[model samples]
Target: MEPVPLAVGLAALLGLSSAVLEVHVGQTSVVSIKGQQAILPLWYTSYSNSRPFVSCLLERRDPTKHLQVLTYIDGKSKVDEKYFKHRVGFLYPMPSPNVSIAINNTQEDDSGQYMCTVNLGDESSTDGRNIGLVNLTVLVPPSSPTCKIQGTPHVGGNVTMSCKSLSGKPSPMYHWRRTGPSFQVFFAPVQDLSKGTLTLTNLTTDMSGTYICNASNSAGYSNCTITLEVTPAFNAAVVAGAVVGALIGLGLILLFALQMFVYRRKKKDVQEEMANEIKEDAVAPKTLSWAKSPGSDVVSKNGTLSSMNTAQDHKLYPSKPPSDTASVTTATGSMVAYKPPYNNPRGGTLTPTPSLSSQSLPLYFPPTVNGIHCHHANVPVHRNAQHRTNGAQPQAPRQEHTLPPGLTSSTLTRMGAVPVMVPAQSQAGSLV
Candidate 1:
């Protein structure tokens, strides 16, 4: 009895007339367990690209009519029961020219040995030296790792996470990897690297994830995926403190500006008050002082022409405005106008009669060089300032004159007031 071939898989050739699946096929092939259904891929043993492939027709070699076509696999032989039982196609013409084995409806269990042999026939003659071997050990991901999580301590603190509940023999190789990405692995047990713990010294948002612990021994590999779920340590308390501090600083700045404004306002008010006082003092009216004079400039003895001086500087002086009293309505009316005897002509000056023009106060003062000959003293000094008018000082009133010893005796009677003559003894006493 000849031995059956250890492999059964697809075979292809560029141009071949006869039906013979004789080339070394790849570990993964296009095979279907149920007609027109699905396909399965095997990852391990691969075909050599250097050789050409050929697929043999099954009905040409089936010695018994009971023999049916079936396929097989290599590493995943434990999952091969479905591929043996499912019907594929019937053999019609012996040694048919082209027989295409279309793949359909495949599952993980359809991964192993299949055959095209006669039922109750010699098993040795059914398979040949060019065996059909498919390496179909499929990958099965382990359960999700169950573990607790904690937040990162501080900004610069380190963090770590562990993977648990992995099965198999040889104390499986632990590879710390993360899913949702293909990263350069930091640890793989085949490379004699680190174990389950993944440590990050300075933790940040980039360090969090669903970590894939690739645990593998000889019993085939699996992945225990755990999520680290790292959270940031920054909080609201620190930000609030900064805002409060800024507000306090702004308040201090506003208070300082207000104080400066108040100080300037007060200083300007004081300056304005001082300026007003200076202006009042400058325009106040003052008395005029004159020296003793010769001739008409000398004083006269008339108690009526008082030389008054005010005791106060700010005393009020009201003067009659131009429109206060009536004026001469006509020159003819002036001849009958009311007049005062006090507005008479000066002493030593005889009036023939009052003229129409010279009504009162005749010879108010004659224009002279630097002097006036007054036969009377004018207004008295040492009186209240109410007598002053506008800013003008009051002129002294006329006085009655007394004749000198040498003048004629009638001169004394003509003058209404007397001259203030001091006795020679009194003058001598003043000089002493």
Candidate 2:
């Protein structure tokens, strides 16, 4: 090969120097027990006492004042007389490149950040690249964590809980567990674990129990417990049921009252109707008949004989009457003149008139006594109209009769429709 170019040769030399100017691989944080020897190992990749001399400086992390612990160079070392007189020194001399240091009889104050820095010289390219920190933490077991819950524990509520281990060599990690019939551990999420707190979402009855918080570090573990009691909330189903039951009960009571009111009103109406019918009968003309005709079709010109013959056939009455006016039908469907004996003015008597062809007929009463106005077989009665008779009238101007208060002709007809037992005296009186 031809002679190597000078510029390319210089570039290769600089790359080789950069590769070898790094800190050693084994140098890392140091941990030890109090009152024991602690070692802070540090080394460089390349060793030389030539142009840029090698040196190592140890520093402690102090903000107000820079605390320089030791300085080692040229195979010897110097330490701060006040803090590290006999406690700190180099482990090996120059030419060997073991820039490691040690602290004999390490105290509690030695547990802090210790930085080891190596320098070739002011003009060296790797000035800050060879620096590292040996974090020194003295051994101490974890203290018992003080566990506490922060909020009301009820169903559907969220609560926060905390655990703190006050003393440990390194910061302790915390885990929560529940103690009951059997042990139940809680695996908190990553977010909760970072803050050493447990957050329970949508709490339930099952979560109420003795809770334990375990704290651990490199030295040992410790735990503490707190009892948790969750209160119950109102049940929606029970409240809704009570409201519905009350409404149903009220409805039933109202319905019962309405039925009772109707029954009492109907009973009072019936009693009043019977009394009025008795009074009417007491003042009625003795010539009036309760008689059936010869064949339900024929009647005598003498009303007395027909009344006597029909006294035994008292089954013509109905239990209930129609709401509309009563009507009488003849063979030709004609409405006939029906005159009540009370209206005759002849002391309730009738004159003997010529008999007609036999046909079945009902005894008709006039409209005067109770609003019992008659309607034709084909016509309807208007309640709002003043009632009038349809038959031929006498020469005298007649006087109209008014019904008793609250009494209508339909009501009177309904009362008359009810079956009544005629005593023996009434039969004898009728015969006489």
Candidate 2, 372-401: lDDT as tens digits: 443222121222336656652232222233
Deviation in angstroms for 279 in model 1? 99
Per-residue lDDT for 268-334 in model 1, tens only? 9999999998987797654333212221132322211222211121022211112212232222333
RMSD of each: 20.9, 22.4
What value of lDDT does candidate 2 attain over all alpha carbons?
0.56
Give each model a TM-score: 0.23, 0.33
Which segments of model 2 are wrong by more than 4 Å? 1-38, 43-56, 60-64, 71-78, 85-87, 92-99, 104-143, 151-160, 166-172, 188-191, 199-208, 216-221, 229-432
Cα lDDT of model 1 overall?
0.36
- TM-score of candidate 1 relative to the true fold: 0.23
Instruction: State each model's CA lDDT, in order.
Output: 0.36, 0.56
Model 2 CA lDDT for position 137: 68
